[model samples]
Target chain A: MSDNSNNNAYWAANMRIIKIFLVIWFICSFGFGILLRPLLSGIAVGGTDLGFWFAQQGSILVFLVLIFAYASRMNKLDREHGVDE
Target chain B: MDQFTLNLLIVGATFALYIGIAIWARAGTTSEFYAAGRGVNPVMNGMATGADWMSAASFISMAGIIAFGGYDTSAYLMGWTGGYVLLAMLLAPYLRKFGKYTVPEFIGDRFYSGSARMVAVICLIVASVTYVIGQMTGVGVAFSRFLEVSNATGLYIGAGIVFLYAVLGGMKGITYTQVAQYVVLIIAYTIPAVFISLQLTGNPIPALGLFSEHTASGQPLLTTLEGLLSDLGFATYTEQHDTTLNMFLFTVSLMIGTAGLPHVIVRFFTVPTVKDARSSAGWALVFIALLYLTAPAVGAMARLNLITTFYPNGTTEAPLSLEEIQNNEALDWVRNWEKTGLLKFDDKNGDGNIAYVANGEANELTVNRDIIVLANPEIAQLPGWVIALVAAGGLAAALSTAAGLLMAIASAVSHDLIKGQLNPNISEKGELLAARIAMGVAIAVATYLGLNPPGFAAQTVALAFGLAAASIFPALMMGIFSKRINNKGAVAGMVAGLIVTIVYIFLHKGWFFIPGTNSFTDADPLLLSIKSTSFGAVGALVNFIVAYLVSNATDDVPADVQELVESIRIPRGAGSAVDH
Candidate 1:
């Protein structure tokens, strides 16, 4: 029963990390890229506003980082939880 | 070799490679057929998924869409890629842990009802079939242009090739072929962009070049593009022209729709473990970003190139004369595409010069922007082999996606419908045979539709995404997240979503999209301030609310079923939990 409890705790921690990273991911793309475009109108990147950059290029770059971060962290989590393949 | 022969040879060789791989990887068992025995590596699966997800619209038409619509169309870029984040966070890992062969399988098991499964199956079919028709039409367009064949003939040829591989190899075959396709497509796409980038901005990287200074105008690339386009009465390339509310809803809808697509979700099932599935989605996005990052650049640069081609002295000067356009070999692509009836230009008002203006009312020249990507190499005076390679690449994009969609359809028929619900006792061998037969029939139907597309390629794809968003997305999400969603509730939600979305689309587009029956468009949608394109997200929301309300009114879910939901929630021990 203790082992099962520990496993559940481990899974919960992993989900917590995913949720946090996903929030960042969501903000970068949907927030900065779309909804917050007007707010980001003052900050310019190249010829366009920061929000435009976020929509076309910046959000995609951040997505790459988020994914890799999740992968590396989750792998470590898997090992700690004794669930590593 | 001549351009025609080179195109045939390159396309032929690629088709042969796909066929060879299909035969070698031919699935012998149901497990191999559906999920390739779940042995695919994260990286390989990522590449295959990238190829599967990047349809002809991404490869051939996206840049053109952006080129014309400018910053207003950034929704396409954001909406398409934003969905990957949703998939990674909300869907991928849990679904992978659920360990189902199809999306409907999860719905059925999670809700514990055959009727729910049937509803999910119907949704999947409608979305997949509609999606596959678009892909088939893309294949036809690519083949017809490059091979100088009729669209119908090209579609038949494409159907024959897809039937060869998809029917033979199933998921196992399609996975490996898709990897090859990713390589061909990325190379085909990036090489020309790199060349154009260097030519226009002196930056080797297309993505960077998009922001770099335009060598000709001595201004920031995007700024110059915006100025030139606005001068010609086009929307600014970097300015927001679409209504903010519509853009927000459209992007959200696309993200949800992407997460819910059965074909894409099923790709995750091929990974060996739940954790791998999570990372695989990341890797898939990484591969996809390589092109997504470059597409906007291609769109901006291609538009600039096209403008400069006509207005050599900038938009302030008179446009290129007819003799100049006809005599220039660099502009031969325009003439070539004109022959196929895909590209057209009329010297209206009997002017010797072609006025390339974006004003819908005043512009006499009508150029199908779809030709821009297809004719980019020719427009820029690239080599014959590069042009031929583009042909092969476009075909790869179209064919790979078509094969994936057909496989998804076939599996839904064989696994979810026949074996799981109808037969239950059918042998694995019989099931595999049924899958192949279903695939053959699906291909035949798609080919027939391709021969006579109800609408243009991009328009049909929008409908496909709409259907997926409205029906499948809601049912799948509610099934996993809301345990109280009873079988009846889930079924009711899916049917409601499907009917509403389809009826709305039909009313706006046409009944069965028969072309003459449509009453409205993006300008005058049925609902208050809602376009047909944005209706899918609304439909999905309605599905969720209805499901929740109905489920709340019903008896509580069985305790054991709740435990199953708990099992799916935890990532730990899921790898070992797979039923052997």
Candidate 2:
């Protein structure tokens, strides 16, 4: 990471990963759980629809996975870009 | 072996454990005092963060809210946990690389203005102080209920315990003590959930039991709950009843606020490196999920249990007669809680049986929402020690969060104000003394407020979150992400965000939360379908818009500040957190 371009490239890659994960975050919580809930009412989990499960339980599980996944991806990106400490 | 002594023994044991940890982990330097010397392991830091984040609200009130609010309150479940994702990806690592001891110090340096630092401090104090008052009151409530003391005595004892540890050990003591607190709270929380889950659904794991069969009715647990609630004229347990827009904004506000809260943010500063900071947040969320996952099951189950207690055969069956309730050993909890004035029953229609229904006039039971979690073990007949453990867990949750908030407040006053401005040449030893003194003062103020709380004590959670989301989060994000945002833009954005959020909250919640001064009520807020709690996201948008416009209209950020921003972007050459 000696040059300005290298730093910029590393940052861009990091942002790309963040944007992708954030999309999943949004879809799982706000979309599937709220706005698009009615579309998923046909699918049942336990006693309620999948949308209800997503709202109460599934969204939280997804958030946990998203964070750990981001951390690993960013760590790998750091080494690939020679930005590892 | 009696319930009161058992409660005293367990509560006493936990307090002794905390004090012992404090003495063992006492800080001798400013580094240790403020950031735990930046030597903490990532996993241990994660556990500490869990206890620091899950306050009395989470341990005590969240399940009750979820039990009654049903699908509408999932906003809280997702919002609080989802914010960890934002913190890890957007904020924590870069802030760790910046290597600062406090949030305002990072703001002060990044924006290159004393005024920006001052604004950050003000925002930090207001949000944290509001937050701490709730924790103090929670501590009082837990102590009074479990220890059989007056609320005032409970608060004083709680304050003295905090002063001993926080004043003596600072962040180092708090970090280790919070780890122990996390273990105690998680165990205390999950043990009864497991028993209830098994009893109700034949599953040992409460989270799994939530989606499993209800053994009594041979239906899914949630489905049975939904059926029971609606049969009794209550909203279905698994359906969304609130408006989509309000729920969306409210969840967004809570997420942003969780990411930006100064107390929670400062926990990341305790870890050794930027990578540790990133992964530590992930670990923290994992710890919190242990309780968060079990909470829904507890809520749904407790609600079901309460309803069935009244209508033993079913909701359609005749309700319990007063004679049955008075004689049954299982109904002992009702009698116990009734002594505290938390549970009450009346024969509104002059019938022999108690009526629990949605209609106001004929309904005969009035239970305070706060007692649900405290009274849960007994509700399930889980035995004496389990109930005692809940008392300890509630205190652990309250005290851990109160310590973290006090740490944030103390550091802001001592590190940002006194060392950074008032007495720049103060010795390190002198600064540590000031920090301890600030902790003492903060604890005193928090105790006072807890005793004579403003009418909005319960409402302050929304205010604290709104202020953090509206003001602090956006400024910190822009400071790291954008080089064009100058000092004037940051200050203008923060003030605009703060004022808009506070004014909007006051419009509905009264001026400074005074009861009678409100112009509009939350039932019919000024904005269409947007409660004051949900206005944080909008305030954040206003902040960004004002900041972008203001930055373009003003002079560009200096060259040095641009370099500073670039350096925080990468994790290379990162070091331990710095004070100056």
Candidate 3:
């Protein structure tokens, strides 16, 4: 691929993955954590329901994973495109 | 030793250690002063960033807010930590690739206009100064509670120490000191939490302990908590109290604002490269999550412990007598907090017993939520040393964040305003002198504002987040995301966003945050039924609209600025930022 097309391809791929991750972020925090909390109230975890767990603890853990996943994957993308510093 | 002496010794030693680090890591160059020579390790940067991010509000009052507000307060936890995903994915790597000394420097370059940079500086200073006041007040409270000194006295002492280290070593000293602070504070925070968790639920991890069954009731902890709270006429532990739209908007505002704060944003500049900036954010969140996860547990467990202390047999049993409240060992935390006058008791019916309930008429005990974390060790009957350590931790949190804000303020004046805008030919020595002088000025201003603090002291952190979300965040995000936005669009957007958010805040809060100046109270806010804290998200929407709508009429960014955006995005050839 030409340099222009290659860079475009890389960016397109990155954005696609970012879009997917953003949905996960939304679901974990704003979705299950807040808006849909009542829906999951019946399904109990240790004490509270799944939504309460997601709101307080699970979202943060998911956030942690999302960041590391983004970083490692982006680094891999950079190497594939000969952009590695 | 007495608790007072122990508090003094531990706090005193921590200060000496910070000063010693400041002296050893003293910055001789502007790069060192501003960006710590861009050589910090990812893990260390993460730790420093964690310490830099969690202020006295998080360390001292977060649990208190959560403990009182219950699950509704999860917004603070989710709001604060959730922003990191935005930072790491959207902002940090690009800013690191742009390789600048300061946040406004990026704005100035991206817009190719000095006026745009000036607007950013205003947004930064407003949010940061308001935020700093919260830290100063937190310092004052920690000092007053532990040292038995007045709040104002503690604030001045804290400011003086910050001025010394910040003016001397700059970001270099701050980085190492914050690392040490992270260690002290995390330990101080977690020890009491672990003890309390083990005490209540037979689970050592506070987060898991929250889910474990309460040993006394042999029921799940939250279920038991809901029962006790209902008996007292308070909101249940697991139900939502705030309106869904308000909660949703408020969380969005805090998340965006946490990502946008200039002090937090500038920390990424100290890392080595784009990759490290991304990784450091993850590490930073990991360190921060250690506290955020534990905070809710601390809130719930402490509430459980407190309520159970009052009603030993159950909610059906007779409450503690006034004499028992005064004499009981578990009640010592209440008495100690009573000295601060934040905890109060009155037998209104002449019943003589402490009739504690949520009933407006008969409730005799009035306890401020801010006392929860400060009094946690005492509530759990942890040792005196742990109490002293918490005092040190509160100081560490307050001072580290203050130092970070002072640096942000100083660099904006010396680097962006003076060096970049006014005197392009200024020498390194002259710049260093200006930076130190700027540090002095910033401290004086922050301390003055802190002393005569605005009405938003309790929610000042919220105010800061709102301003950031409404103004700087949109401008920065658009500058990278859209090539069509030129200087006029960016400037208009920032000014419009900032004015709208601040006006909304001032309308509910008094103008200039003076108590009587507010036209409306939070109980009855104007427009869309939104609270002042939630308006930032709306303001952010306004910013994007004005920017795009204005940009349609205005010229596109020049070719060089467009290329700069493209370059920042790729992140392949990232290198250490050197002064132009």
Candidate 4:
């Protein structure tokens, strides 16, 4: 492939990963935590429902994991694309 | 030792430690001053970012807000932390690869316009200055309550300490001092929390203790608290009260705002490489999560403790009498807080007992939200030293954030405005001197505003977040992702977003935040159930739409700027931040 096409491929792959993670991000916080909270109200975790847990604690933990996981994934992708500094 | 003397010793020791760190890490060059010589390790950068990020609002007020707002306020916890994900994936690595000293430099180069850079500087200063005023006031409150000094005296002392480190050492100084501050603050925050957690749930970790069974009642802690609060005619602790649309928008506003703030963005520049920048954000969220995860528990537990104190035999029994509050040793926290006038009691019906009902007429006790965290140690009956440590931690939180904001403001004035625009031919040393002078002026302005705070002092955090989300975030995001967004499009988008958000805020919060000039209130918002704080997301949507329409109508982006976008996407050849 030409260098331009190679760069395009790398960018596409990175965007794919980001799209998946963004979905998970939206699902955990805005989805489970807020909008669809009533749907999960029947399933209890500790004293409250799953939605309440996600809102107060679970979403924050997921955010930390998402960031770290994204970092490592990007690092691997960078090396694969010969873009590692 | 007495509590006041212990507070003095601990607070004094922390100040000396910070000054020592600042002196050791003093900046001698423009590069050192701006980006900490690009030598900070990613993990260290994370810790420093934690200290820089969690302001007095986070340290002193967040738990109390959550305590009162309950499930309705989880937006804060999610919004603040979730923004790190956006920063890491969308902004951090690319900005690091581009390699600049300040956020505006990236915008200026990416959009290929000085006008865009100037607009960014305005948004940055507006958000940061408003944010700093809260910190200065938090410092005064912390000092007066802990060290037995007057509020004005505390403000002056706080300003002097920040001046010594920030003007002398710059970013280099602030970074190391932030690391030390992070240690003092996290320990100060968590130690009392552990005690309270153990006391309430027989669990050592405060985060898990939130989920564990309440030791006293043999029920889950949250379940017990909810039952108690409901019995007293308050909203259930685990249920939502606000409109879902407003909550969603508020969370979105805060997420984008956190990603958009210039002070937080610039911290990414201090790390060595693009890879480090990506991971550094992860590290930052980790350190921050230590406090963030604990905050909900602190809020729940403190609320539980407060209610149980008022109604010692459950909500069905008589409340604590005035004589009991004065004579009982365990209720000393109430009397101490009472002297500050933040916690007040009035027997409206000529009842000797303190009534804390949900309704206005029957509720004789008016308790400020801030007292929850400030008096947590005393309420839990922890040792005097622990209370002193919280005082020191509050100051650390306020000071570290103040220094970070001062750095952002000083660098924008000296580097972006003065060097980039006005005097492009100035010498390096001249710019450094200008940076120091700008920092001093910013500190003075921050202190003055703190002392004579605008009517919107309590609402500054929301305002700061709103402004940053509406104005700065979209501009930076577009500059990176879309080569088609030309200079005019970028400038127009930012201006539109800023104007709409600010006008919305001013309409509800008075013109220029002065009292009695508002056409609307948050309670009866101008928009359809949308408070001004939640309008940033809408403004951001407007920015995106306008930028796209304008970009399509006008000239295409130049060929070279396209290459710049592609280069930043890849991580190769990332280097130290350039001076220009």
Candidate 5:
């Protein structure tokens, strides 16, 4: 029963992490990149605005970081939960 | 050597390399054939995934789309790469831990319903088959332009080569060859980009060079582009021309669609462990981003180069006359493309000079966007070898993706439909034979479709993403994340998603794309500015909604099924993937 409770706790923590990352993913790609692009138009990035940079190049960079961050965090989480394969 | 010979030599060398790699990595068993025996390294799998994921559209048409569409085309850039974040965090790891040979197998066991599994297979086949048709067409175009053959002959040769490698080597063969392909394609893509960027901006890294100062004009690239465009009576290059609603939904659709694709999902299955699956997606995105990052630069710089080629001084100079275009030796590339009827320069006013406007009358220069990337080297006056390398790169992009999609289709038939359902009593040897036979048949059907495409393959590729997003993504996410979704609810949700999306697509794109069959045009869409291509997000939302509401009315999922979900979520005891 204790093992079951501990397992639930671990899974809940994982979900929390997934949810947090997903929100970041949304903000980087859709929020900053597209919807709020006009607000960032005044701030120059390279020759273009911040939003255009975020859309074409910056979003992809953030996506790469997000994946690696999730992977490293999950691996540590797996160890903590004693679920390491 | 002459230019033709040089082109042939470079392209043939790449072909030999691929065939050699395929021969060296033959599959010996069903495990090796289907999942590459689950022994692939994470980075290698990532490289292969990168090659497999960047299909014909990304290679052949994306730059052209970006060249014309400008600021509006960010949906493709962000949507395509953004999906990997979802795949790594939401899908790949858990699906890898599920340790199945096929996605439908996971769906079957999770839903505990053969019918639901069959629906998943159907959706997979529909998406994959449409995607392969586009690749085959791209292969034909690349071949015809470079090898100096007819599109038909080129397609035949392309089909034969794909059949040789894909049928003989299976997943193991495809994996290693895809790695080689990634190298060939990236080098082929970036070399020309570096040259063009260096020519235009002093920076060699194309991504940074896009916004950097233009060396020729001594102005910011984007600012110069906007000036040149408005000078030509076109829209400013930096403004949002399309509705934010359409752009937002389109990006969401492509993101979910990328994560939901069966071929891409199966690549993760080839990696050895769940941890590898997580890391491999990151590496795959890095490789994919290498080209994707350069594409906009290639597009923008190519367009600027094109304008300068016409003027030689700047936009203020008179456009090249029809006689100059026809007789000038510098215009040979334009003439060559014109012979294919894809490029046209009409002196609409008979002023001799060409006029290209973003919209509204008095337009004379009509260039197919797909030809821009292919014509970039020639437009920039790069050497013959660079042009030849682009041919090989385009073929690599199309063929690698076609093989991957064909593999997914074959496995769905052999593993999911035949072995999983119809012939559970089949022997292992028989299953392997079936897989090979299925691959051959898929290639043949794809070739036929390529020869006589339904005219909507490109549009349908967007629909493929819609279907995958609407159906597969929701079900798979729910399977692991929520045990409350019963089999009945999944079926209901999938059906609803499929029907709504297909109906929406057909209404706007035409039923089967028979011109007069469309109920409404994209310009005057029935659903308040939502294009058929952008309907996938709506479809996905409907899938989730219908799934939750229906599942609430049904009995709860079984106890052991709940346990199965829990086991997949934790990522433990994952050794070799096993069958139910």
Candidate 6:
């Protein structure tokens, strides 16, 4: 394949990964912290509802995991696509 | 040693360690001075970034804010940490690939205009200088409280210490010293928290302690806290009271602002490869999480501890008498902070008792929540050394962040504004000298403002984030993602975002934070849907839309630049990119 086609394919793959990770990110912060909070109300942690946990602590943990997961996976993808430095 | 002496000794030793590191790792070249020669290890860099990112506001005041604000203030915790996700995903790796020394360099190159770079440098300096003032003020407050010095004297001392290290070592020294500061601060923060956690919840881990049962109440920690707060006429700790729209916008604004901060973006430039940049962000988040996760627990538990101390029997009983507060040496911490005017209690209603009921009507005395974290060890009847360590930790947090911000300001002035754009013929030695001069001037300005802070430390921090979000975030995002965004569009977006955010902040706050000139309250912001805190995200959206609309009206990006944007979009060919 030509470099232009290769570049197009690579950009497409990168966006795909970013989109997936972002979905999880949205779920944890917006979903768990706000919209889905009522659903999580029954699942209490400590004295507070699960939603509060996500708001203060749980979402932050998930954010760290999401970033690391995206980064390492992208590194592997880079090598696979002959884009590794 | 006496308690005071012991406190002084520990704090002094930590400062000595920082100075020693500054001496050993001093930067030898511009590259080392600005970006640590792009060879910092991921884990070490992460720790250093953690120190750089977690300012005094995070270490000393964040928990206190959460304790008082309850569920409404979860925005601070979420807004701050959530931005890292945006950083790792949208900004860090690509900027690393650009292989630039400063944020303005990337902006200038991508726009193919020196004018664009100059605009970015102005934004960078304005945002960074405003941010550093908060750190310097925090340092002064911490020093005055612990060292028994006046605020002005403390400011000078703080400025001197920052000058010694930041001027000598640059980014290279700052990075290593930050790692040491991180250890000192985290240990100082967690030890007292662990003691309190174990005492309250029978849990050694504070994060878990927040979810565990309160030993005295025999109820889960959060439930007990909520019940106690309501009983004391305060809002429930877990219930949201702020407007939902405001919350959403505020979170988004903070996320973009974090992504846009020049000091933070520049940290990625220290990594050798794009992969390292990506991984280092993960590591940095991990280090930050160590503090971020512990903060709410500390906030909740400290509130509980303080309430218990006041109502020794329970909220059903009479509050602590004024005599108890005034005469009890165990409560010396309260007296200590009161002297600084950060903590004050007025005997409103002429009541003889010190009742800390939180209802607007029932609460007679105004209490600054910033005192809670600073006074926690003392409230818990912990050893005097613990109190001293907390003081040192607060100072470390402030100074580390100040150093980082000063370095960012200096590099933008000397490297991007002077060498890259204005004086291309300047020698490297001359440039380095210019950088040093800029750092010194930045510190002096910060110290001067810190001696007479216009607002509280945390409020000033919000302004910094707002500026970064409005100006830098939009430009960088457009630079890499939108091929059609011309230099005109990018510059226009930044200026629009910047002016709107700054004017809004000025209107709500003072004009340029000069005090006594604000025309609006935060409750009645300029736009119906926008709070000043949340306007950064709004400005960012406006930036995107304006850039797009304007760019479409103009000619398309040159083909070569289109290809460059495409190259940056992919993860491919990232690992081999050299830092320099």
> For all the models shown, what interface RMSD does each have?
2.0, 0.9, 1.0, 0.9, 0.9, 1.7
Model 4 lDDT, full chain set: 0.85
Sorted into a CAPRI-style docking class, model 1 comes out as medium
What's the TM-score of each model vs. the native?
Answer: 0.93, 0.94, 0.95, 0.95, 0.95, 0.95
Report the TM-score measured on chain A for model 2.
0.96
Clashing pairs in 4: none
User: Which has the better DockQ: candidate 3, or candidate 5?
Assistant: 5
Record all residue pairs in model 5 with backbone atoms less than 3 Å apart, i.e. clashing.
Answer: none
Residues B34-128 of candidate 2 have per-residue lDDT tens digits of: 45526777778889889999987788777877888888888878888999999999999999898877899999999899999999998888778
Candidate 5 chain A has its poorest 10 consecutive residues by lDDT at A2-11
**lDDT value, residue B70 of candidate 5:** 88
Model 4 residue B110 lDDT score? 87
Per-residue lDDT of model 4, residues B1-580, tens digit only? 8788888899889988977776666635545644552676778889989998998878887888888889998988999999999999999988888887888888889889999999988888888887887777677667657755566777787778778867775433446778899999999999999999999999999999999999999999999988988887888889988999999999999999999998899878667888898899999999999999999999999999888888887789889898899899888778767765567898778778998878888898987675578788888889999999998898888878887788888889889999999999989899888988887877887788777544323346767888899989999899888889998899899989998998998898777666678899888998888888789999898888898899999999899999999899888888766542
| B454-498 per-residue lDDT for model 3 (tens digits) | 532346687789899999899889987788999999999999999
DockQ of each: 0.55, 0.83, 0.81, 0.85, 0.86, 0.72
Better of 1 and 5 by TM-score: 5
lDDT head-to-head 3 vs 6, winner: 3
Lowest lDDT block of 10, candidate 6 chain B: B571-580
Q: B137-251, model 5: which lDDT tens digit per residue?
A: 6776677677666667777888887888677754334577889999999999999999999988989899999989998779899888888888888776667988899889889
Candidate 2's displacement at residue B469, Å, is: 0.6
Residue B532, candidate 6: how far off, in angstroms? 1.2
TM-score of 1: 0.93
Candidate 2 off by > 4 Å: B26-37, B149-174, B425-459
Q: What lDDT does candidate 6 reach at residue B206?
A: 95
Clash tally, candidates in order: 0, 0, 1, 0, 0, 5
